[model samples]
Structure formats: C-alpha cells, structure tokens
Target: MSDRQTPLLGPDVFARRQERLRQELITRKLDLFIAAPSTNFQYFAGYNPGRSERLIAVFVPAKGGSVIVCPSFEVERLTRNAAVQDIRGWEEQEDPWRLVRTALGEMKPQHGRAELALEHTFDYASYLRLAGVGGDWHIQTAQPVSERLRIIKYPEEIALIRQAIAITEASIAATFAALQVGMTEREVAGRLSEEMRSRGAPGGGLVQFGPSSALPHGGPGGPKLAREMVVLIDAGSPVEGYASDITRTIWWGDAPSEEFKRVFNTVHDAQTAAMQFGKPFTTRCQEMDRTARKVIADAGYGLFFTHRLGHGMGMDGHEVPYLVEGNETRLEPGMVFTVEPGIYQIGKFGVRIEDDCLMTETGLEVLSHRVAKL
Candidate 1:
C-alpha cells in the first residue's frame, strides 16, 4: 500500500489541466476543443454529466474561457459540480447543435474552416449533427491533445492508482483465502466483487479457472474450480478516476504439474526482465514488448503467448503508449502500464503474471504486490 493518502483533486488542478490543454490547442493550431460525457469530460470539466442521447458537452476555446451544454432540466445538478459558469441548457425539443454553434461563435473569430477537435467518445451520429452545425467547421480527433496530457501521470494520479491497486490486491487475496473446491466461477467472482466493494473499491474483476484461463478475457460462469486446476484473476479498481490493473495465475491444488511450474517461472522471468530494463524515458514501446517476448520465445512457448506484452492504464484500463509490437511511442517517466506475459496451451492451461508498473528515472517501479507464488 502507498504511504501517500489519495485526496480529491481540487479546482486548482483542473485549472492547471485546462490551461495546459489550451496551450496544446494553440500548438496544434486548433480553433476549439470539445469534450463529451466521457472521461475527457470528467477530466476537464471536473465532473461527469452522465451519458445520454442528449448532447451534453464542454467546449474549451484555444484562447478564452470555456462553456458547458446540457439539458435545461439538468442545469442545476450540473452547476453543483461544474467549475464552468457559462452553462447553456436546451429544452428537450430544442436543437442542441445550435447551442454548440452559439458557443463556438462566442469563442473565436471564424476563419476559413475553423478546426475543432472532438473527443473520441462522440458517436458518428453526434459527429454528423456537429458537422451540420456549419460555420466552416472541420472536426478532427482530439487524440494528440488528450493523449499527450493524460499519458503522463502527475504525482497525485500515481498515488490514487496505488491506493486502487492496494484495494484490489487485498480483495483478491481475501477472496482466494475463502475459496473451496466445486465453487462456480460466478460465485467466486461475486465474492470477489463483494470483497472489493466492502473494502471501499468501486468494483470487482475477472475470474477464471481451468480451461477458461486460456481465453485471456474469459467471462466468469459455468466453470467449477477443481483441485489441480489453474486459477486466474485479473482485476482493476479505480480511485478518483485513476485505475489499477493486475493479473495473477496460480495452481490451485497441492500437487502441481512440472509443466505448469516451468511455464509460471518463464512468465515470471519475462516480466522481471522487461520491468528491470535500464532504459530511461527513451526506449521504444515495442522494444519493451520484444524484451519480454524474447524471454518467452527462448523458452519455446512463444506461439502460446498470443497477446501484446501489456497496455497503458489510467482513467481507462487500456489507453495510449501500448507496450506491443509495432508501437514506437517511447516510454517516459510518470507513465504507468502493465507488464503481463502469458503462455496459454489451448484446451489445457495458461499462465500469466501481471504487475502495474511505473517508469522512473532509474527503472520501473512495480506498484502492485506480487502475491501468487509457484
């Protein structure tokens, strides 16, 4: 568990974020940046307005103040949590896109084809309606702007993720202690969920046993855990929007096969080598994946290791800076991601060991505690 206490981010933090993004907007030569009711909304606006068919959004200009648009009925509720004062609420029958156009008019002088960056969560229907709003608007992805800021963690964000990982690790440990033979995967998953919530976590995680472990993302149900079967638990709990992800595979029975032990060790070593790599803030993302993949392939189980080494984790479980083949993004400090290397033998068993890792000035800091042993 982290010694740092996770506290609520204050208005100052959001203000800093908004200012930073505005600079990014100017750098990208964009006119305006719009965020829907997604993580980006929660990120910049300091609250979530909840997702609906209604076109609720936050509009930030490249050089001026921001505004929010939501249903007129929701104005009061949104006001309580939002820092933006210029809240424009439309009635049920009103054209919300017109309101968006009005907000744009107040933002900047409309040059030729004013470029607008839309948060990726907006549906195609929303995009079409937005495009129809006219004013020579050009809608492009907000990826470069959003991903650049979010990919790097502030110290507070790291603390929150650590707290979340502590909760999930404790919940998984508690759940396994109470496990017994013949328990359905759903029952076990339910118990895990209960454990996490009881410990103040937002939710539970994934559980699999025996052949189900081979599926990687297998749902929990139908399978009954038996002695000598492999047990896999992949979980993440969020703390104040930051996320934690961890996966641990273990042999359930007292008697374990030699092959299982060997596979487990191979995965453990692969993850270790990848984590301990001495590169500092400049190693290509795929280079890290290759480092781990080589270890698995050397053990003659490369074919079974089908998936990427890991993915970036933050407000979303899977985000930018993916540690996989072909991605060339360089790893930088404050970036957090998972280093999970797994080998699955179809219809038989699989082994995976994952740890939430933070890249540092020196090396990777393993955030989650390693609980499973050979």
Candidate 2:
C-alpha cells in the first residue's frame, strides 16, 4: 500500500482548482466556462448532483465568483456538498436555459462579445439552447482549458491512484491463485470481480481464455479452461474517484510451448523499454509509443502489435496525455497513465502486459510494480 495517507478532497481543493482554471481563462481571454453534469463538472463544482434530464451546470467566470445552476428540488442536496456558495435553482415550470443566459449575461465583458467555453460533454441540443438565448456569443469547446489543468495530477491524486493499483494487484493475485482447470471464463471473471469488491474495489473485471484471448479488447467469456491454454485477465477498480487498470496473461495448466514464452517475453521487453525511457519534460507521447512499438516490431511481430502504447488515467479510466501516434504532447511530472504492450496473432494466442505508470521528478515509476510478470 502507498505510504501516503488517503487524501481528503474538501472545499479548499476545489477552490484552488477553480482559481487555477480562472487564470487559464484570463490567459485564453475566455470570458466564462460552463460545465454540464459530468466529470468535468464534478472536478470544478466539488460534487456531482447526479445526472438528470433536468439541466445542471457549474459556471466559472474569468474574474468573478463561480456559480452552480440546478433544478429547484435538488438545490438543498447540492448546497450541502457544493463548494461554490452561489446556487441558482429553477423550478420544473421555469426554463433552466434562461437562468443560464442570465448568469452568462452577468459575467459579460464590457467591450467585446461574451466568449463562452462549454465543457466537452455538453449535448448539441443544450448547445443550441444556450446559443439561441439573446446576445452575440463566441462559444467554443472547453477541452483546452480542462486538459491544461487535469493532464497533470496533484500529489493527492497520485496517492489515490497508487492505493487503487495496490488493491487491484492484491485482488488479481488472490483470484489467480484459486483457479481450477474446468472453470468457465465467466466464472473466472465473476470471481475476479468479487475479489476486487471484497478487497475494497467496487469496479468491474474482464477475463478471456484460450482462443478468445486472441482478441485485443476481449470476447465472450463462456469458454471453459483447459490444460495448455492461454488466460488473460484485465482488471481495474477505483479508489476514491481515481482508477487503476492492469492486464496480465498467463499460461494455464502445463506450460511447455516455446512460442508462448517468447511472445510473453517480447511483450515484457516492450513494456520495460517504454517505462524506462519515459522522462519528465523530456519524452513526447509519440516517442513513448514508438519506443514500445519498435521493441515488438524488431521481434518480427510488427503487424501483430496493434493499438497505441498507453493512455492517461485519473478520475476517468482514460483521460488526457494519450501515448499514441501523432500526439506530440510532452511528458510532465505527475502524469499517470498506462504502459500496455501487446502482440496478437489471429486464430492463435495473444499476450499483453500492462501496468499503470507515473512520471515523477526524476524518472518513471511503475505504480503496478508489485504485480509479478510472466
């Protein structure tokens, strides 16, 4: 387990996040940022009021205070958890869009048109409504703003992610130790899920066996296990709001095939190369992907090694700083992502060794290092 204590994300944390975002707004000349009920909303608002057909949003102004708009019935519950004090509640009979328009009008600049940055998750219908309400608006996506702040995690966030990986690794080890020869893939997946939840992770688990393991994402889990078969288990669970993802492949029953061991070793080598080379403020995302992909390609499995090397992980399983081709984003300290390398041969077996990786001040630290490899 992580030596760091569990982080208590209270109003102060959210307040600091909002202040940092406001500075971004000033730099980008964005007048205001509006977030719908989503992860982005929760990040800035200090709490999520749950999803509903009724409109709910958080407004962060460039120079003024933040506000939250929600249904009248939810105001009481929202107030109890919301970090922002200005809460506007609209009744079912009233149009929530009007309230949004009024809030935006209050934050409008004195000279130019109001430039609004809407969160990425806002639907088209809502966008149209917001656009139609009154004055000239310069509306655009808030992706750049959100990505700037969230791409690099805080120390507390890293601690939570580490805790999550520790829990998931323990769960996977316990479940794998109890496997039998005749168990169905579904049974194994269920057992893994139970093990994760029982060990304080309430997320999900996935399992694949033998021929089904050839598929990268996954396939049906009805196939029964047997001797000389391949087994793949991809498991993840959340600690607090942070997430953990890990993939491990094993040779079940009797392991006697030279090909299976070679493939596993190749994947292991690829992951090691990428993890070792990733440095803070030095490596580009595409460079990391190339480092891992080249290792597999040199081993004569170029075409078989499909997909990107890794992706960013935090509150959402997949976030920013994706380690894929053509992405030139530079690596930074406190960025948490995965380093998963795989080689799949159709109609044969597949091998993937994945671990959550964190870039620290000096080097890349594999968060899932406690888990053993092939």
TM-score for each of the candidates: 0.96, 0.95
Root-mean-square deviation of candidate 1: 3.2
Name the top lDDT candidate.
2
| Model 2 vs truth, CA RMSD | 3.3
lDDT tens digits, residue span 264-367, model 2: 98899898889889999989999999999999999999999889999999988989889999999999998999998899998888988889988989989888
Candidate 1 lDDT trough over 10 residues, lowest sum: 1-10
**Model 1 shows how many backbone clashes?**
0
Residue-pair clashes per prediction, in order, are 0, 0
- Which lDDT tens digits does candidate 1 get at residues 1-374? 11112238877887888988999998989878998887888778777766888889999888889899999998997777776778989999988888987887777555556788999999899888888874577789998899999999988888888999999899888888888999988898899889888988777778999888988888876479888888998888888778889888888989889989999999998988888772766788899899999999999999999999999998889988799999998888989999899999989888889899888878778899864456
The C-alpha local distance difference test score for the whole of candidate 2 amounts to 0.85
| Candidate 2 wrongly placed segments (more than 4 Å) | 1-7, 370-374
**CA-lDDT, candidates in order:** 0.85, 0.85
- Model 2, residue 16: distance off in Å is 0.4
